[model samples]
Target: MLRAMRYLDYAATTPVLPEVTDAMVAVLTGDFGNPSSVHAYGRAAREIVEDARDRVASAVGASPAEIVFTAGGTEADNLAIKGATRKLRGNGNHVITTAFEHHAVLDTVEWLGHDEFETTVLPVGPDGLVDPAAVAAAVRPSTILVSIMAVNNEIGTAQPLAEIARAVKGANPSTLVHTDAVQMLGNLPVNVHELGLDFAAFSAHKFGGPKGVGFLFARSHAPVEALLHGGGHEGGLRSGTLNVPGLAGLGVAAEIAAKEVDHKIERVGGLRTRLWQGIEDSIERVRLNGHPTERVPGTLNVSFEGADGETLLLLFDAAGIACSAGSACQSGAIDPSHVLLAIGVPREIAKGSVRFSLGRESTDEDVDAVLEVLPGIVESARRVG
Candidate 1:
C-alpha cells in the first residue's frame, strides 16, 4: 500500500482557505479596477483594498490608518527597518536587532550598517530566547530603531516582544520598536497596543491567504520614509498600484483567523504536544529546539541525533511526509541552520535539525502518520549516512 501524503509545513505558508479564494476570484474577475483611478470601477476596487486594510488593522489592534500594504512580509520588513533607519539617521545611527531574526530584517540591517547606520545584533540563549535586559543594555542615546521578530521562523520560538519593547522604551523613549510579526498574525495573539510596538510586519500567505500580500503596522507617531519613489501611494511609505485581489483575499483570511484563533491555538497546541510526546517515546537522543512552553502551537523543530539531516529529509519524503529543514525562504540551503547555531546548538547537531509545522488542516491521523513513519525514516537515514 502507498503511504498517504501528510503536509506539516504551515509556518512556511498555508493554502488559501475557500472563503479567501472566493473573495480573490471575485476581485480578480468582476471587481478588477485601478484603485488609483477616480472612475466607478476604480472606486469599487479601492474600497476592497481599504476594507482589507481595515481587516488586517483590526486583527492587530491598530487603527486602519496605521496599516500600509506591502507586496509581502519581506517588503514590509524592508520598509519598516530601512525606511525608519533612513528617516532617523539624523537623530541616531545605531539600531538593535536579534541575531536570529529572519534574513529580511537581518540582511536589511546589515546592509544599512554598510554605510549610514550602525547596528547591534543581540544573541539568544540555548532556549532561543532574547533577554529583555540585554536589549536594555544595548539601547544607547544614538539608538534610533530596535527591530526584533515576534517568532523565530526556524524554531518557532515566541520572543518576548512586550518585554523587549518595554526595555527599549525604558532605555530611550525616542527609540522606535519594530517587530517582524509575519509568523504571529494567525498563529498567535497579535495586538500592537498590548505589545507596545511602534511598527510590525505581517504576511497574509502565512495565514491561509493569498501570497505576495502583506502590510506594515506603523504607529501614528512613528513615521517612516518611503522605500519606493512613485505616485506616493500607501501614505508615501510605499509606492505603486495596490494588489486589489490579493488584498481582498488577505482581508477575508485575516477575519477568519481572528474569529477562529482561540480554537486553533488550543487544537493545534494539543496536536503539537502529541507529536512531541510521540517522537520522544519513539526516538532516542532527539533534542527539541525552541522554548519549552513559550513557543507557538504549530511548530516543532527537532534535531535527530545519529541521522544526517539531508538523508533524513529524503527518507521522510520517501515515506510521503512533507516538512522542512529550515525556513522555506532558504529552501535548498545546505548549511546548518543559523538559528540553531545562534541558540548554541553545535554544528554537527544542527545538521540533523528538521522542522515539522502543523496547521489548521492537521488532524490526529496526520500526527499518527508522523509517529508511524519517523522512526523507520530515522533508522534508514542513520544506516545510509
Candidate 2:
C-alpha cells in the first residue's frame, strides 16, 4: 500500500485552483482567437485578455494600463531590472540591490555590472533583512535603479520595501525603485502606490494560478525599454501573442487570492506556527530561519543541527511528504543557499535547512502529518549524515 502524500512547498509553486482551471478551460476550448485581430473571434479573445489584465491590476492596486504581461517572474524581473536600467541609463549607470534578492534580480544586476552598469550588491543581517539605512547609504547620484525583493524566497522574511523605497528616494529622488514581488503577491498585501515602487514583478503560480504566466506593474511614469520586439503587444513593452487561457486563469486566481488573503494568512499562519512548535518541542538543536513576526505566513525554513537537508528531503519524500531544500530555481546547485549565507547561517547549517511552505489549502491534518514523522526523519537523516 502507498502512503498518503502530503504537499508542503507552496513557495516553490501552488496547485492551480478549481476555479482557475475552469476559467482556463473555457478560454482554451472556446475563445481561440488572436487578440490583435479585428474579427469577432479576435474581439472575444481580446476581451478575455483585457478582463484578466483588469483583474490582475485590481488585485495589486494597479491600473490595467500599468500591467505588462510576461512569461513569468523571471521575465518580469528582467524587464524591471534590465529594461528599466537600460531606459534610464542616460541619467546614470549605477544600480543597487541586496544579496538576498531572487536570482532573477541578482543575476541580472550582476550581468549588467560586467558591461554598461556599475552595480552595488548590499548585504543582509543574520535575520535575513536588508537595512533601509544601508540602502540609502549605498545610493549615489549616479544610481539609476535599486532593485529589491519584497520577500526573500528562501527564508520567507518580508523586507521593509516601503521604508527602503523611502530611504532610496530620500537619497536620490531621480533613482527608480523595483521590487521582485514574485513571492509576495497573493501571499501578502501588495499595493504598488502604497509601497512607492516604480516597478513590481509577480508570478501567477505563486498565488494558485497556472504556471507560464505573470505580470509586471510599471507605474505610467516609469518607462522600461522593450525586451521583445514584435507586434507591439503590452503597450509595446512586451511583444508576443498573449496566452489567453493562461491570462484567464491568472485573473481568477488573483481575484480569489486577494479576496481571501486575510483568511488564508490567519489560517495558514496558525498551521505554520503549529508545525514549528511541534518540531521545536519534539526535536533538539533546530533553528527557525527568517523573522518570527514579519514574514509571509505560509513559509517556514528550519535548520537541523546535525542532519543533512538533502538527506532529510529525500527521506521525507520516501515518507510521502514533499518539500524543498531551498528555492526551486536552485534545486540542483551544490552551494549552500546564498540567501542563507547572506543571512550568516553557517555553511554546514545552511546545507541542513529545509523550506516548508504552506498554502491556502494547507490544513491542520497536514501539520499533524509532518509532526508525526519529522522527528524520526531527522533522526534517520542525522545518522546517515
Cα error, candidate 1, residue 204 (Å): 0.6
lDDT, each prediction? 0.91, 0.92
Candidate 1 deviant stretches above 4 angstroms: 1-4
- Model 1, clash count? 0
lDDT of candidate 1 at residue 286, scale 0 to 100:
94
lDDT of 1: 0.91
In the range 94-124, model 1's lDDT, one tens digit per residue, is 9899889999999999998897688899999
Off by over 4 Å in 2: 1-3
lDDT of 2 at 309: 86
Candidate 2 lDDT over 178-293, as tens digits, reads 99999888788879999999999999999999999999999987868999999999999999999999999999999999999898889999999999999999999999998888
